[model samples]
Target: MKYQLYFDESNKLDQPNGGYSYYGAYGANASVINDITSNVISIYDSLNTKSEMHFREYKDDKHIKKYFRTLNYVLNQNVNINIFIVNNEDAKNTAVKMNVDLTELRKLFYVKIPERLFYGITRYLQSGTDVEIFVDSSDEYEKLGLYTKLKEQMNAHSAYRNKCYKVHAAIPLDSKISIPLQIIDTLMGIVVFLMEKAYKTASSTSKIKSDLIYRLLIEGTNIQFFQKQITLYKWEGNEEQISEIPVSQYITEFLVYKTQYDLQEMGKFREIMLRNPHLDAKEYRKLIEYPNARLRMLQGYFDEITTGDRNISIR
Candidate 1:
């Protein structure tokens, strides 16, 4: 039987104030985790005498990205890693419910992406499997009172659902796991946490929030996706000269264009116009008033760009 393994981490929100801003996690098979750990340790042992492996020693994003990419190339060979990030809003809500005031709990909140990631992965696996979770124990465990509460909530839900997956927290980094695996896990936790912080600090309004979510999704999926779809469009043969287009602009445009294209292809434009009179009026006017295909496309794009059309858009 294959076992599911979940990993997570958290980062401060207010970097200057030492307040954390993000958290995230990934879930995969247990054997994959073991294999990843073994390989990572072997690499580290081989390189230890020549150079030391230090994740916490670096605070620069460029350095961190380089280190993580190297680790990903190694560990990802065996583990299928699915990453998720939690923004500041969600983190604040969790803290509020746990009675930890963000103003007063800065230090206690350092590197919490793991705990949040654990919660997310466990909830997802509630009805899917029987497995145990492992975590790197915090020196100040009492500060993470919210994590304990979330565990209790999961336990109650599991009992009601009659599921048997048990969440067991352990300090694998402090255990017999290979040094490389421990470092990789720690780096994963840090990256997820930073991504979350970037999401929250990027925007507050629903539109901007949706934009940020899409941006993170694109980045987490792979940086190349963003470069190809949003960034490298014109360079890659797109006749549309949108050199100054921001990532958010591309996301909104892509969604609107895709929806309109889909509706046209499915022969649903007429039906949609009939169902929504305003949409019909706009489309009819565009066809009659704007004879230019480019003008019509722009008008249609703006009209279709609603807050609810995209899944990443926040309510």
Candidate 2:
């Protein structure tokens, strides 16, 4: 079988202290893509909106309702979604520790990040399957020789070396025509919104915390279909340093311990929304009170519920 991966990114690296941003990719076979694309076009027909679907541009109730339907389709589809979030502050610290200049850091963030994402997807490919990956149109990689770098990283994997899988190429495509890329755009937006909310939220005891700690917790159960199939990796430096104790687990446990009630309430609300489509005016009002409030608050709650407080490290 042949597979195609559609990827999109949210936010910019230059935005210092920008809470969270990600490069999210959606992968599936041709059959699944055709189905998803048909359903997406049907949604546009129903809404009668010529506007292209964009996560950040979704504002009004009508737009948001349609957006939610699109999100529901993504959750139910036969596809794999993987997100890699990089904090600006963390990247800076990593750069300082590794003694890398800004140019090197940029390559690591834009080029190396996607390469790791593809590596995670290799396990899903079987013998005789050819795969092509596309990202949203961008020129950042033009001078960096993205395709060449990607081949080097992808070919390094044992599966590719053993001829168990074939990578066709990496290319950039217009998001306007690719429904899969649009889906990834929404996915990345939701993850970023959740992380931002988590970072901005204040603790009960008024203690300061590291924002990166909340990154792992920004996962959602809607995509649990791809949970174990997906890998979330962090590139801190060139050399891997093993921590004596799993401090990340402790941080996750503390966050979950602190947000139990909020998570339960969000779960109950989610069930209600899913079952009852005709929410009252008051509910709609609540959803629109703040900017991206519904997605932001609910995702933060979902992240808390879905976050795994375990010990796992990537090399």
lDDT of 2 by residue, 95-182 (tens): 7888996557767766557655655555657777877777666677667666556655665563545756666777778888887888
C-alpha lDDT (0 to 100) for residue 47 of candidate 2: 76
lDDT per prediction?
0.40, 0.56
1-315 in candidate 1: lDDT tens per residue?
Answer: 245443334444433323333332334567765676566555555444323334443332222223433444443343333333334554466567778876444444433323333443455453556555444454544455534544454455566656656544332334233344344354444343333243334222222222322323433444433333221111111222312223444444544643454355224444444565565434654643433322323233334443223222211
Q: In model 2, which range of ten residues has the least summed lDDT?
A: 204-213
Stretches of model 2 off by over 4 angstroms after superposition: 14-21, 97-99, 109-111, 158-163, 198-231, 236-315
TM-score: model 1 vs. ground truth: 0.42
> Which portions of model 1 miss their true places by more than 4 Å?
2-8, 13-20, 49-56, 59-70, 78-100, 103-129, 142-151, 160-163, 168-315
TM-scores of all candidate predictions against the true structure? 0.42, 0.64
